[model samples]
Target chain A: MTERGLLIVLSGPSGVGKGTVRKAIFESEGTDFEYSISMTTRNMREGEVEGVDYFFRTREEFEELIAAGQMLEYAEYAGNYYGTPLTYVNDTLDQGKDVFLEIEVQGAMKVKEKVADGVFIFLTPPDLTELKSRIVGRGTDELSVIEERMEIAKAEIDMMSHYDYAVVNDKVELAVDRIKEIINSEHLRVARVIHRYIKMIKEL
Target chain B: MTERGLLIVLSGPSGVGKGTVRKAIFESEGTDFEYSISMTTRNMREGEVEGVDYFFRTREEFEELIAAGQMLEYAEYAGNYYGTPLTYVNDTLDQGKDVFLEIEVQGAMKVKEKVADGVFIFLTPPDLTELKSRIVGRGTDELSVIEERMEIAKAEIDMMSHYDYAVVNDKVELAVDRIKEIINSEHLRVARVIHRYIKMIKEL
Candidate 1:
């Protein structure tokens, strides 16, 4: 029987190379996941275009979806709007396609609440100090800002229990390979609940 | 840091080829696992020496271990004493070797009760008719015995929810290979409860 695509929810610390790992997963062997395009009100950067980096939308459209309960989850950060569209994810999954969502810790939790059987993947930085380095390397934020990000990371890591699998993103390529492996492994799992409805071939 | 092994308990219906996969796991890619040698009071079969198939022991000796709480879990099946030795399993696990325990459902449950962190794998036949065919192929007894066995098999398959993982034994080699993959995949699972104590390294 052809296996259904896994609904994988992946999240990581601020700079654990999740994007790199995500790219590698698409390039890996036997991986059947498709990225779910998220609708956002944030304007595109210099070279970014609609339907590329994001499904860029206006504030009215985003709010209309939110008002209509079309948004799976959404939040405003630094005066920017971002949200996942319920229709896009549902359509992909119903067609037996695995869907990937690049979301924050809060968004991850929200997605899980919306999808009961969602598989949560928590990506970790190789080492805590390395994570701090990556955070600070983003062009010398105040030490206080770096420390605040570290604190947020600690809180995010603590939510690891809410996740089904955790990947250490020391090397982006390897982490992506592991993520792809996780999707493959999940397909082999038996139904958590099944009835004994036997179709008797011999009796027929 | 080197990862620790997962304690997996494998159980299933009699004709589901658990033994076949068990053997394949050892013969194929189980170099990391400490295949648990169970202790039994039953007489050894021809060429089945002590500590290989089982740790042949006297009934009194078995009772002594049970009394002293050395046995992880024990059962009296068809007038034979079968049990897992706790000390041997713990010692081997401390050395970072994965452990595979081929046990019955009841004993698997008991072991889970003892070790809350244990992972359970339940194997199932491809179909009910296939199970009956395999049981009849054994040429053990009459129609009544075969019927009784089928009834038990049905009950066992229905109990798959109690297990953490399940794989259909459609092909012995395939099932065995999948089991190996599950073990390997589990080893890469960094968020298991026992593994939480690992201090996430902080490095650039």
Candidate 2:
């Protein structure tokens, strides 16, 4: 039997460039991971393909899936539901295809509770100084605003304890490389691959 | 303070090319790991450097170190004592330079007991059939000898459970790449790197 593929969850605090890093990873050559498209009740935008941009679903269909416990994790915004389909993720993994999820920290924590075996990676900024500068660099020089942003960032960074690996988003390319290394090494982990050897020994 | 470097122990069954893989790793550019130079009581041959080749020591010195618990692991072969020096390994790691030890399965296990945090990697052939072919290819086709060799190989493969990673030495370059990935990913592991972030948080 083929080994199940990894469920890779990439998350970080707001403004840490999780989306940029995820885009770089997917665009890089030799990345065979299947991006887990969200099933959304929102209408498809211009130039958006059916399954490419998002798995566009009617509100009734999306709520039915949610009611049936088919959504891995879901959130409603502006009266629309967005979620990862549990069946698609499991089916793809069963077929030995890795599924990559790029979500916010709170959403990632919810997924962690459900998919305990998923590889949770926290993409952190180089340092709080850098993160602070990024926040200040966003044209907001207000001291209280900066302090509040830093406070939120710290809380999210504190959540890193729940992650298995932390990749510093110092450089997009470097973060992508480190994430790739994590995936490769995770595949070679003894716990994940030992069953094959055990089976081989039994056959011998 | 610099984070202590990892103790990477690479071992496998006999004839699994541990030496070859280790050599390839050191020869590869960007490999900054320091190979742990063993201390031996054997006389230095011509053109052998004192510290680079081996830490040449008299039998008395070796015995004193062993008795003093300065020897990490040791064994006598052909009346010559050979062992890893505990002091050197600790000093190098304390200086934030990784120490790579390429040894046999028995020596690896000993190191595991002494240094529980060491990254133990077991290199194995692609499969038992390939391993058997390698034995037969050695021109030792005697049924009894072949069976004995297979049994030994099986026993060594079973030791893989104690290792953090199992790399199949299917090709020298591929094995080298996988080992590099393991080291890179290990450095990113949350357990090894979270302290820095904790410190960063405190400073913030």
Highest DockQ scorer:
2
Q: What is the lDDT of residue B118 in candidate 1?
A: 71
Worst 10 residues of 1 chain B by lDDT: B195-204
Model 2: per-residue lDDT, tens digit, B34-119? 99977888899877889876789999999999889988888774468878988889999999999998876767788989899889
The 10-residue segment with the lowest total lDDT in model 1 chain A: A195-204
Q: Candidate 1, TM-score vs. the true structure?
A: 0.85
Give me the runs in candidate 1 sitting further than 4 Å from their true place.
Answer: A1-5, A43-49, A140-148, A188-193, A196-204, B1-5, B42-49, B58-61, B187-204
What is candidate 2's fraction of native contacts?
A: 0.70
Each candidate's DockQ:
0.35, 0.72
Stretches of candidate 2 off by over 4 Å are: A39-65, A75-82, A136-148, B39-64, B75-82, B133-149
Local distance difference test, per candidate?
A: 0.76, 0.86
- Tell me candidate 1's fraction of native contacts, as a decimal between 0 and 1: 0.31
Model 1 C-alpha lDDT per residue in residues A46-163, reported as the tens digit of each score: 7766885688989989899999999888877446677888888888887778899877787788898888787788888766767778888888578898888777777777777788
Model 1 - which docking category? acceptable
How far is B39's C-alpha from truth in model 1 (Å)?
2.4
